[model samples]
Target: MATYRPRVLIGNWKEDACLEEERLRDFMHKRERGELLIQKIDKLQDNLLKKIKLSVTKDGFVHFGDTVMLLNPDNKSSVENNPGECSRLTLAVNLDDISIHSAISLQAPCGVSATKSVEPMARNTFCILSVDGGAVDEPIRFGQNFCLGTTGGFSDQMLYLASDHKSFIRSAKKSYLQQVFLTDKLSYLTCWRATFLDPQLRLEYEGFPVPANSKIIITHCHTNRGLAVPGNFWVRSYFGKEYEVVCHTYLDSHRAEEDKNYWVIVTANPSNENGTMLDRPSPYPGETTKNEFHEET
Candidate 1:
């Protein structure tokens, strides 16, 4: 009598490592998807903005919704690493928001990176709303994008503005590998685009004075996480007027008791004639310098 048996094949070290990496990625993607679904449900169930409130403390901290974010001032060492002081602001959010099952906590720090892990807390939830840049007086057409899932742990939610009461649609995911593996520059740009460029929504301080027919580009150094602090924004007006705006968030030491966060905006000369200058020199060869603006925060 002859018996036939099949032997189990074992994966080699490289194969096993690849498998482990894939599994980790799958787990992260699934978690992000679940969080997004919960956010959508929350949005449908309640008006997030109504439930939440935002205010700056007398000292300098930001009171977002029910959470109070404590801003820690950056030291000289940290400032040297960035273009300006307070380049890297440490924000501590009150955990109360998590208890109410609210999604506002997840979205407030949309593009900013968390310095540490908080138990039972999900990453920030973000959405992008793009609107026609026509005359300010004219009616604007808008679109949105929200985070669905990410490829290699890097994804930006782009949301379109809907006409309904709950006016955001999670339309697509924009993936930038550098953001996931290299730096947070892309994330900062994503937030900037949603906040400053979107004509439908305006941020505090009347947003960044973006002019019509002008293009705004965000540039920064390669940082592993958080914003490319002391980020740069190149704004080129229609009439060939170019301006550089420096954006940085910092904890005001003088107002430390108030626990406030501040964003300093300074305009400077352009780095090149074309008004496009990167934080680091161009990586590609044959690049030439042009008229540009340099802003300090």
Candidate 2:
């Protein structure tokens, strides 16, 4: 291929070979890639997200890699809310819950796809990691299907999210948490539900762009459960204190618990730019040439 020249047919009797050569030439010239500098690849995860002040965005949008806090704005819980405390998602699982540990054993079946290599993927759970230590920011689009990361926190701290469908074999209702990671293949395991504004709008909102700062849902696209925070489920961690973030659907009326799943994408860096009108962004279908992306700030 290095020696092959474009449109140069040096011989006859070459039918498919000529076409393939042309295709390769086009591929070599037509590849489009964008570079985004989000943060230092080796930067320490000192729970930087916790230091971000909870504030609204001016542009009212979120783009990829824009540091964000998945805030469950619902103050309905009886638990006390400190003025400066921000309870974001974390990888801390209830160590006492044996079922979760067992659930981790069965995670090999999660996110299985035809193209993805079949390998056992353990839950990102570890008792040593603090409840609010650090985590990757998940994606969302109102009235669109998506995914998030959970279990043990992702080490890469990049795009998209993963989850553990706890008790799929034991209970009828499945629960999952969204954890972020970089990947080329997308499947139902990464699919989370994001319905905001109006459910009725979904019918008319296909291909309609969603702005940032809009409250959206983070749930598995195929399950009744959604990403939720146990308001009262607090855990003492290496860092003072943090909230135990769980992915359980409200056993009662699903509609009543909508507030629990509410999340807003905030600007990770609000200096010169807010996020963007990209809260509901998706990659090109069948994209194979490096699908991972980050903010070009």
Off by over 4 Å in 2: 1-59, 64-67, 78-160, 168-187, 251-256, 268-297
lDDT of candidate 1 over 124-230, digit per residue (tens): 11211222223322211111111111111113432211110111332111211122111222332332221222222333424333221112222122221122222
Poorly placed runs, candidate 1 (over 4 Å): 1-122, 131-292, 295-297
- TM-score of candidate 1 versus the correct structure, residues matched by position: 0.20
State each model's C-alpha RMSD to the native.
19.6, 20.3
Position 96, candidate 2: lDDT: 24
Error of 1 at 254 (Å): 24
lDDT score for residue 213 of model 1: 16
lDDT of 2 by residue, 1-297 (tens): 334443455544265477778987766654432111112211122222213222334454443233334445533451355444443332321222222233212122222110111111122211111112223232233445533333223343322344544553432121234322223344655565455434444566544434554455555555556666555545443233445455565533323344455554433334424332233243454552231111121
The superposed Cα distance between candidate 2 and the true structure at residue 161, in angstroms, equals 3.1
The per-model lDDT (C-alpha) reads 0.25, 0.37
